[model samples]
Target: MSSKTYAGIPQEYAKLETSKIVLIPVPYDGTSTWQKGADKGPEAFLNASENMETYDIETATEVYQQGVFLADAVTENSSPEAMVEAVHKTTKHFIKKNKFVTLFGGEHSISIGSIRAFNECFDNLTVLHIDAHADLRKSYQGSACNHACAVYEASQTTNLIQVGIRSMDVKETTVLDPEKTYFAHELATNEFWIDSAIDQMTDNVFITFDLDAFDPSILPSTGTPEPGGLFWYETLDFLKKVFTEKNVVGFDIVELCPNKIEKSSDFLAAKLYYKMLSYKFMGENVEDDYDNTYESKAQKNNVTKFNDDEY
Candidate 1:
């Protein structure tokens, strides 16, 4: 959020009209229960991105060449409901322009708005939620917009598949679909988890990734750190497969509580964002047209809900 352009990219590629991607920064952290520094996540992540190498060794590509437009930060913090509405409207504004939208968050709660926008724009949308906590509560702390209820609406509307979850209250079990929810303990032993998760997803997928999904050993700067979480390569392996197999409409990464002393977490978040973009545009030429394939009329149609037995 501090840099003029994302990662200090050239002005030519950062223009909104020509850019294929739009990055929105929401620096609100009013609902996090434990850690308080997630509001600083976007600034820290941007600073780290400015210092990172643009060329991706694994993909043999410079994704920044595809053009990244850094939109103004959404600073609506007067109330949680008002903030979510602001994010929903701003995110939808970019999607309507046919740009690939991505967001950096203050906490998991921001996903409630981002996911809502994507679900309304795309047909049969799948929300692939990767996090350490279930976050399935319909309401928490007298607020439905709290971080704990981040994906509750997605659960009802989209083909919501949760992964890397290791901690949650017993009450969430009533809402979580066991067949689609991959717990961390089970993932460690399930050899086919990556493929299985992808198989359950619809053609259009929206990824809502919480930084706490990574193990505290590798990414300790998050609001809530849990044991038995994911590692770097394995996480990338799953994401690459998703980008390769499904139409990943857009994505959001959240819950980065940066520590003044530990800088690795910020760099990890930056690299993660770049890597996902690389996977998305690896095969496309920068000169070629980029269409996000969002349907404006789909906003009026209700996506048919499915029962567990339907799958």
Candidate 2:
């Protein structure tokens, strides 16, 4: 398993004690409705990552120099409720260790625990949700922990800012905040919508990215790929702004159902993960080899005060 660490880097750069980032793979898909095999998401991501170039041209930095430690994937729990509980406990443990924890999920349901843990660690956190579906059902399939209810708790506990959402039941409109949620159709040609979305967020941000946020033409391997979604470059533009303007404490990429015939989706997921890391550490000591020496500069440039005048 160690041979397949992200980017397939050597042990010197993947050690737990010296690493700046921790990658937690949650490979449990107990509640998927339409498609199965999402449990293989983590391995597919890791496998694709092994073939990635460490150097990122857009950010002009190789983020792996900061040391990305791939921890043991959470492989227990038979039910969605138990899986969520286990993920929360594991995520909390990592947060307590002061590590920048990133989660790769089996399904959208896994994010409930990760988001909860981030909220506990970071104050005034705003969840920057990028997904095709709202996943906002109050209780789906007889359980609150169902994939459809991934962010129900987040909506109640934290300031939820959803973007790229094109699918949702009308009943969920009750819970959706008009000011914070940006629907896909409304943002068709409006560049200003990015500012509108960012305006509702706090300085401390935790991103929950569902892979289906991309259009089916771009990433059709997800369980519920909706059409008319954000394409690759456009999505990156928003993400770069989020990482630059806000202190993204941590993020999770979920709901990648890998296909045997088409491996592009898996590769794209891996690239997205690495690109986010590069953006997060853009101006830090990311150029040189700082495997055991890099320190976080997230708070140095974050906009803590809410600029209501701009809004």
Candidate 3:
């Protein structure tokens, strides 16, 4: 990572020993088929975060005090599969430290690794995949690690709940469960979609948020900009409810393709990240211990198994 501290916080809160949170930046954009600037996302996000106000008004908390250790950027780009493996190992390493591990990504494919690590550590994992596309292809372009197949493993292993879906391939429908998917059109009219989506989640949840899930009018810098997507307040409302009701083990935000002329998207990504952290650690003391509440290895024996052959 280019920045010394996450959001330029003092060294006290940026140290790994005292920090309650770990932020992993995976700046590999090898698999994005559209816009190619997602590799620059982590640096742009860090730069924008440096200028953001640490205080959050809604929660009335400075979540940065919880300490954010910005780990080295995952630069393993030999192949899409290699990058995913590197991300999986790094995320698992932090989760084992009992830290609230979060990731900012180069593309949606990075979620495959982070989600895998979380699913292994948490029992009865529910993957909340918020994206414009279904992204359920078992494999794309001869590689399962392609961005297009980001959540195929989760669909088979975890209780996957999809939201804000407006674009998808017909083949993805075979893997998608309509009962658990909140399509953009349905969400537009459904007054209780938030509650409904939350109700279907298991106790342990891992969120994978794609930037394109937001409408192009609000966030147009994603690799794939989709129309008729989510807005800010409503997205925050849904996220707050999830953090409040579920054991949100970890999360990752992906698909940010920054533009030099338009910097709002970068700031939005930074604020969105801080907002999620605020919700997670709201009302908690920095001195207090943060237990990610992951299942012990023995306890995870009964959890949904991840099969490499399937992927």
Q: Model 2, 1-311: lDDT tens per residue?
A: 55556679888879878777999999988999998988999999998999988889998888898889898898866788888888887887766555688999999999999998788767778998999999888899899999999998999989999999999999999988888889999888787998888888888999999999999898999998899999999899899999989888899999999999999999999999999999988889844554332123323423233222422
- Candidate number achieving the greatest lDDT relative to the actual structure: 1
Ten contiguous residues minimizing lDDT sum, candidate 3: 297-306
Candidate 3 residue lDDT tens string, 28-139: 7998888999989999999999999999999999999998999999999999999999999999888776678999999999999999898887788999999999999999
* CA RMSD, predictions in order: 5.2, 5.8, 3.6
How many clashes (backbone N, Cα, C below 3 Å) per candidate?
A: 0, 0, 0
Once fitted onto the true fold, the runs of candidate 3 whose alpha carbons sit more than 4 angstroms away are 1-3, 289-311
Better of 1 and 2 by lDDT: 1
Local lDDT at 14 for model 1: 93
Q: lDDT per prediction?
A: 0.92, 0.86, 0.90
All candidates: TM-score: 0.93, 0.92, 0.93
Question: Could you tell me the lDDT of residue 96 within candidate 3?
Answer: 70
Residues 111-191, model 1: lDDT tens digits: 999999888778889999999999999999999999999999999999999999999999999999999999999988899
What is the Cα-based lDDT of residue 212 in candidate 2?
Answer: 94
